[model samples]
Target: MLKGKRILVAGAGGLLGCKLCADVLSAGALVVAADINLAAMDERLQQHGIASDDARVARVSLDLSDSSSVEQFFCSLTDLDGAVNCTYPRNKRYGAKFQDVTLADFNENVSLHLGSSFLFMQQCAKYFISNQRPFSLVNISSIYGVVAPKFEIYENTPMTMPVEYAAIKSALLHLSKYVASFMSDSRFRSNCVSPGGIKDGQPEEFLQNYRSYCLGKGMLDISDVVGSIIFLLSDHARYINGQNIVIDDGFIL
Candidate 1:
């Protein structure tokens, strides 16, 4: 669906990010695998079947938190079709308990992740606008952003939804809406995908509680999100904009 296209996959070393890169490459788009850590970028590319000399794949170190870096990165690209941002920036102790949340951590996360996300989106919009081209941007949000977190699901688990994540993701949906409508003027498209809990190694008790809330399976895998992302970035979805497509397996219902 994305043949001959040039797509940038930010946070390409991450779990969802790597999966998205593989899928985009399979769809025949030139992927710029971008992440902060260059040391791991090559390994991530190799894991996704991209070789060092592969013309279709380019590796770049991106500090999404840096505005100058963001601008320079976008400025360097040419014939860019679109981008997918799956970057999740957080401090060292990210998963803080709800009551244990601190203002310092909250502000740092919000400013770092949320602020960087805005700069990324805005920079992409600016690039497309200057080039007078049509492009699509997909921002990864969360199901928690769509609905309040179910504290019951995390009852026996060692997890509680962090306040900063909720704040950043929920606002991201609105930010996509704003970028799609307020930035482009019909030339650029901005959309969001809000995914539910992707199973890693959560306890059975948490998984069971989570399943009870789902219409189908309990949690999602990388494959579940890749297809939706490809469709959104493809020309077939050219008409889709200012939309938040939720992929939570009915967890929100």
Candidate 2:
């Protein structure tokens, strides 16, 4: 869906990010796969059979936490059609149970994730305004952002939905809308994709618990969310702005 377009996949080393890079490249977009870990990002791309010298894809390093790095990255770009922010920055204590979360940890995690998202959105909007081109910015959110967590699903597992995650993601959806509205331009679009639990080696018990709430698939594979993202990046969704597309089967129902 994204042929001939130049799309940037930040956090390209990550699970969803890597898959996104490969799929978009497959669809003929010139993919700029970027992450702080350049080597790892390259490795992930290779794992998907995308060579470093592919010409259609470029691997670069980007640290979303640093303002100068983000500014320089945007400044260096030209003719960029779309970008996705998949970077999940968090402190060491990120996944602590709700009751076990410290105030400091909560504040820091929020700052790292949500704060960086704000910076990214700001830079993307600036890029659209300066270049005077159509640009789409996709923010990865979670189903937890749209609905309260089902604590029962994690009953026997070591996971409890982190308080900080809920705060970050829910805010991201609104922030995307805020940027789109602030831009007030049909050319600049900002949207979100909120996916349910992606299978990442969670206990079978937890998986079964999760499946009970879904209509069909229990947990989505990383690939399940890619098509929607690519759609948002392409002209097919040119009029779809400031909307949150949830890919959670029927979990939220």
Candidate 3:
């Protein structure tokens, strides 16, 4: 559906971001994978049978915390048909317990990621408007944004859902919705995708505990969310705007 489309994937070095980039490339789209550093591992990309130097993929440097960097990245590009923000900005206090959550870390993290998303949207709007091109923007949110964290699942585990994430992600949905509605052209749409817990390198006990809470898919692979993202970015979903497509396996229920 996205053949020849040029997609900019922010936070492209991370696990979920890399998977999305790979999928986009497989669909015959050009990928401008940007992150704080172009640290996407060759082994990781090749794990999916995609080579690191594939002609379709271009790696760029980006830092979400800096507005100048965000603006510079967008200004440097003229071929972006769509952009996706899959950034999960964190620091020392990210996974801290709810009680231990501090205002400083929360605000800092939110400001950086949210600021990046904002600048991305602004530049995207400018680019689309000035170029008279139809464009799409996708913000990666979490199922926790839809519903509160089920504290019970983390019991006996060292995990506690970051309070800052909840605040930031929920705000992201509203931001996307506003942009979708706020835009003049329906073609320049903004939407969000909220996925459930993606299986990473969590402890075995934590994994077991987490798996028991799901309805169908016990835990998500990074690839699970790619379809939803591709759909939203492609022209096939032109009718979809100002919407939040949740990819959780009833975990939020």
Task: Work out the TM-score per prediction.
Answer: 0.97, 0.99, 0.94
Stretches off by above 4 angstroms in model 3 are 41-43
lDDT score, candidate 2, position 5: 94
For model 3, what is the error of residue 97's alpha carbon versus the real structure, in angstroms, after optimal superposition? 0.8
Each prediction's RMSD over C-alphas, in Å, is 1.1, 0.7, 1.6
lDDT by residue for model 2 over 1-253, one digit each (tens)? 8888999899999999999999998888998888999999899889988888888888888989899989998999988999999999999889999889999999999999999999999999999988998999999999989999999999978888999999999999999999999999988999999999999999999999999999989899998999999999999999999999999989999
The model with the greatest TM-score is 2
Q: What does candidate 1's lDDT look like per residue over 1-253, in tens digits?
A: 9998999999998888888888898998989989998778778767877777888778899999989989998999899989999888888978898688788888898998999999999999989978877788999999988988889888877888898888899999999998887875665999998989998888889889999999979798888888999999999999889998899888888
Among the numbered candidates, top lDDT falls to 2
Report the alpha-carbon TM-score of model 3 versus the true structure. 0.94
lDDT winner between candidates 2 and 3: 2
lDDT against true structure, model 2: 0.93
Descending-lDDT candidate ranking: 2, 1, 3
TM-score of 2: 0.99
Model 1 spans > 4 angstroms off = none
